[model samples]
Target chain A: MTSSGGLRGYFVRSENARGFSLLAPTLILLVLMMVIPIIMLVARSFWTQSGMIETADFSLVNYQMFFEKKIYLYVLGKSLLISGSVTFATLILAYPAAYFVAFRVKKNKLIWLILITVPFWTSYLLRVFAWKLMLGYNGVVNSGLIGIGIIDEPLGFLLHNVNAVVLTLAHAWAAFAILPIYVSLEKIDKSLLEAAADLGEGPIRSFLRVTLPLSMPGVIAASLLVFIPTVGDYVTPKLVGGSSGIMIGNLVTNMFGRGNNWPMGSAIAVMMMISITLVVCIYLWLISQVKKRSN
Target chain B: MTTVAIDIRGVSKVYNPGSNQAVQALDTVSLTINDNEFFTLLGPSGCGKTTLLRLIAGFEQVTGGEIMLFDEEIENLEPSQRPVNTVFQHYALFPHMTVAQNVAFGLERLKKPQAEIDATVERVLSLVKMKELGDRRPNQLSGGQQQRVALARALAPSPKVLLLDEPLSALDLKLRQNMREELKQLQRETGITFVFVTHDQEEALAMSDRIAVMSNGEVQQIGAPTDIYEHPVNRFVADFIGDTNFLDGEITSVNDDLVTCRVGSESLFEAANSGNHSVGDQVTLFLRPEKITLSAAGDASRQGRVANIVYLGNQAAYTVDMGDGIELTAQARPREDGNLPFATNDTISVDYSARALRVLAK
Candidate 1:
């Protein structure tokens, strides 16, 4: 009885046991909602689909086909290039807006931050469609320019290409890039700028040496936040990406829906996730290396 | 002849510190600090001592007057353009940079060669005695160590003038005392004109070759530590610098620099005077507590019963209640055998030299 009670007490009274109990509900929900699906997806990746029937035997046939096809690799590389551009474009656009909120807007900072997030309030699909209206062949930009007599004809380059995908994704994920950078900039000591000036640095040089480097953490976070999600975004690419902007996500969707290849889709999906994870790890390592030398 | 390091001529600043609509923070304040001298702007918070310092440092523009650094106009120059650096109140060391990096920042900004920059950084770091911790970031070091790095960083460029804004206020009492001597020694060793701003009168007295006591956006008095402590020109300076007994009185008679005052019928009489004040002019007599000696009531100028006795280590303070609503505080060292001179409720004589008291125009 003592031994049994001792074992029960360990489960009930230990720090680890108490902590686990606190997170028990969240853990259970996460396993049910996320972990089980991911495990099933991995399992399906090793299966073979044969004409309206999926054979559940373990096989690498889908993987072998993915490697055999060069289109998948090309699309994946294009997706990476597009996502990288999106991250860069969003960062450059967001940095100044975030700086204005963090430094210039002494009053009503909350209003400024909320205004940044206002564009993202609508449904994601609608926002992508809105970008469609703005950048379409007979879009607002092209039509407005034509009406102003600035151009002779509608610019076909305005829509349905890699540029359209990049512009739309960058605009969609702008708030994520801005808020973190704003927080980092706001956390910097204002007196450091004054000290920098006192130490004989011009306004521009002071900002480059002190303000830019100090706000790197937020910059890195913003980059990853924009890059990771936009890499696999299919809706924006499908609506605007005609040929050149097609990404890995579109390929996976095709295999699952029209192509009738669930195993191939799973395999492609798993590979995309692995690729994003690998890129993020490398980016973080490079950022750390740069930071180490800054000191 | 000594050269003037900073010639602040009628430099008035009108600034709104966000709390109020607009405060004339510095009012036509003029001062001349000599080269290589440690000058202090001593005042309580919001008294415009810091405003003057900031104006001199080129952080703010003067509304009315010009400031000359080494006899060259600098009010229009940017804070960066001025050849001066500040040791900020909070140090403001870059949180990301290591100690060595922070020290090298100023040198590197001047476009000095890499070897010269490295050597200067090394020398200043060791001068502040933070040689081994140069690799540690500001956040990793203790407050005192960060203070040394801030000092080293400000000193690295060897600016003509170094403005220190209460850089020792954040440290504990013991550490603060140690830093005070070290900072003074640094000023001597570097021979740089040090402009120190602080509210602590003792720190100013101990460190500054000359102190400018400020009040209500004006320079109340500017003199050496001894002159400021001993012969304050106005009531504000006398009251703000130390503990003193202020007795409102009318000037009864004037004799050169000595004026006799009538306080509550019994004119307890002549005190040192400043400026021109005719007889019957309203004035105040201030006597330092330490200047007064306590003894048992005898044939004396005035007598009061001791109302309270506060036992301080090595000394005691006696609150004496004289007639006509007048009370006086006198501090006395304990008797040679380690006992107080008198207990509470005992009548005592308040004895002070006429030279030890001063009269200020009300």
Candidate 2:
């Protein structure tokens, strides 16, 4: 009973103990929802899938299938390529927007931030469907082109391709890229720019030498945030991607839903996670190298 | 012939112009800083010294009049285009760059040869005695180290003039004093004009070849350190430079340069008249505390009882009530035994030379 009272005193006195207790509910929920599901998936990836009955017997057959199938390799590569382009496109679009909002817009900054995240309030599925309508045959772009007499016929190439997937994905993940980059840009000391200018660096050179390099952490974080989820995303591809834009996520979805191959789906998911972690690690290492070399 | 490095003519700056909240920061201020000279702009905070410095650096634009750098009009130029560099008060060293990179920044911006940039960066870093800490970032070093890096960075391009905006204000006393000596020596060695701004009068007096005393967006006086301290034209200049007692009185008799002033209702004191003042003219006389000598009892004419004694090392300040409600502060050196001579309520005689008690017009 004395020990129990002492433990209570420790809980009350120690900030770390109290902090962990405050985080306990969220931690337990994450363990149940995410960690246990990932563990189950790993276990299922090692099991054998025979026709309709997936057995508890551990084997490398599911992993072997991933290498043996050419379709899986093609789709996985295409998915990675699409996500990579999406990440690149979003960064290019987001940087200037974030810079403009951070440096140029002095007043009503909250309004600008609210505008960036406003798109999130609507349904993600609805937005993807909206992109489909915009990119589809006889859609806004096609009709507008026809009305302007710019093209003789509807551009079928706009839809049913990797272009549509990249476009939709880039648009969806834009705010994630912008907000972090904005925060980093805003955090930079304004006097550093003045000092650079005083040292004879013009506006363009100052931005490149001082502003660009300093905001790299935000750029890296935004890259990972967009790249990780987009690789496994299937909804935008399903709506606007049509036949050509189907990716690894589509295959995983198919194996789980119609194919009833949970073990195969689990294997593909695990492989995707592993490959992404490897890519992000290399990217982060390269960024750190660049930062150090510049210094 | 002394060439002028910066010739700021009738320049004025009114922040937020044409608005109700417009503040007149500088008003028709004209000053010429000579080349290779250590000139100081000395004033209290918000006294337009910084405004004048910024105008010369092209950081802020002038509402009227022109600024000439080395006899070339440069008021319209951008801060980057101007051939001047600033050592900001806070150092403003780039957090992302090492001390070497920061020092090399200006040379790199000028597109100098990499070899030349390396040599200049090395030279300037060593000049500030920061050669060993080149690889360390600004945050990694102490305040004084960062200050050296800032100075080295500003000097790397060999700017025609260096504008130091109270750079030593961040450091503690000992470091600040050491830096002040280094900076004065640096100016002499480099032969580049340095325009230093500070509120600390002692720093201005110690380092400047010429000091410009300013107040309320206008220059009060411009002269050598001794000229400013000894012969301040008005009450503000005398009070700002150092500690001085203001003895307000009316001139009873004028003797060309010397005037006998009736002070404290009954006492008459002789003072040097700066401006043309006739008999019966009201004048304010400024007497330096150190100029007045204090003794327990002597042939000194003015006698006063000590109201308060403040013990300062090497010197003690005594507030003396010189009869009839006239209180004046005076400083005296410690005795041969290293003890303060006067205590509270002790009557002491005050003696000051007629030349030391100069009068400024009312």
Candidate 3:
């Protein structure tokens, strides 16, 4: 009987092993689709460009070129600045709206959340195109301003500029910012607010100390959601950014699409990924420091 | 010497506007809590005891009347503005904060100097005997420990009135008993006006100097715990406060505070005080379980069959199956002779003095 029991235990362990093995296909697929490509991109960054197949020789020449060329450096700096601005603006706008949705608008919460997410249901490219029309020289915005006599003529700053790209990205990612913030605010126990009030905190103080700090996780998540995608987006800049409005993403796209420099493009892509990872790590570390000091 | 800490005059709360199903949570409730007194609101569920506590805390608005705190009209004041702190039923400690941080939250809000806040937090934590666990987060602590932290947090503010809403209900039985003693000690040490809300009669009796027994959104009776337990004003209060053997009878004779009642064909009972009773009026006499004495020998006033005997540690409780649809319980103290006084299936007589029985108004 003991031997049979041991055999049954062995069978159970084997069943678990079989279950894990069944999951191997999906795991392998994910690695192939995501991890392997990223690894390849990083590896390719070290290779020098050749006629057809890149040179087998590896060097830091591509990275040096990224720094040596003022255009690439400018593009990288502009990309960081633009994405940072978008992130801060999105958070500023989203936090209050999310607080309102979570605390004030109690009923039909799901419906409101769905309404926020409705923009994502339509094609992202279509949304960009719609923004393009709205910001065009003769579009609704320019016409409205001119109609109201705010300006003598249509301003060239609205379309095919950095402002247009930033505006489009902000509109596109507002939903991302709102949802996580709403969820975090919703998870806060109402009694905490009451406790704050009972502890002699006015409405403003309670909001600053309790509500804002507790919702940090959501803010971090929203920041990452906007920053990560905005850093790598070539489409928005390509359509809306004119001559001087080019970013690192557009540079990388040019290397692949027009310049036919795959190795160079992969190098730029790897750098962008590294920069984003470093920024996110620094943000997370800073937040942890703040949390530690507060405690 | 006798400043009223809280004066609630004719307060009521009706929730939900422009709806047919609006509930009158509190109705015309008036109460005066003396300074430094441990007052308890004791009631069953949905009795608006917590609502009353909240109204005093300034967490809820009084629909009609006014609440005064230390001669100040505080019904319109915010919760923060009132010199009151509440220990919530769930002990709602900030989960992200450590015990020390939770305790310091109120002081921080007061914007006291750093040194003062630190000293106060440490003092309160030590008061709750939770100084060692101050560094631990709320989730890391046990339920009893969390309760202490909550108490420390509320007390750290040095509020005049401390409101506890079923604070001990979450603890285990043994822990609850121990915490009750600790809480009483703390209250005595602090000498703050404590307004505790609880549905547990034993807790109310053990803790409070005075208890207000509430039901159906109204205060049925409010008095010292002994009076509330022994001389409950009505049937609901009597039934709610303790275990009582109710004898239904008609008052055959009445004179001032004395009333003679006939229980059945032969048995006659005399209650010392029948409040607002007339001759030939039907009333219920509430005799506590411990008040009745069981004897095997026949008594003139009462007789019954011993239906069951429960052997509790120090005392034996006998359930007498009095025929004519009446049942009574009597307790017998353990004796050195080691002889069982009563047994099941044995006929016995249950007797109590006239003073032991309270005639409750319906």
* Predicted candidate 2 versus true structure: per-residue lDDT over B167-227, tens digit per residue: 9999999999999999999999999999999999999999999999999999999999999
Report RMSD (Å) for each prediction in the order shown: 2.7, 1.9, 2.9
lDDT of 3 by residue, A112-226 (tens): 8898888899998999999988999998889999999998889888888888888888888999999999999999999899988988888998888788888989999999999
Q: Write the per-residue lDDT of candidate 1 for residues A1-295, one digit (tens) a residue.
A: 9999998899887999889988999999999999999999999999999889999999999989888999988899889999999999999999999999998998899998999999878999999999899988899999999999999899999888999999999999999999999999999999999999988898899989999988988999999999999999999999998887799999999999999989999999999999999999998898888877765
The residue pairs that clash in candidate 1, if any, are none
Give me the candidate number with maximum lDDT.
2
Give DockQ for candidates 1 onward, in order. Answer: 0.81, 0.78, 0.69
lDDT of each: 0.91, 0.92, 0.88
lDDT of 3 by residue, B249-338 (tens): 988888876788888765678898646788778788989988887777674466788888889878888888888777888898767787
| Candidate 2 structure quality by residue, lDDT tens digits, A222-286 | 99989999999999888888899998899999989998999999999999899888888988888
Model 3 interface DockQ: 0.69
Q: What is the lDDT of residue B80 in candidate 2?
A: 95
Which candidate do you rate higher for DockQ, 1 or 2? 1
Give me the candidate number with maximum DockQ. Answer: 1
Whichever of 2 and 3 has more lDDT, that candidate is 2
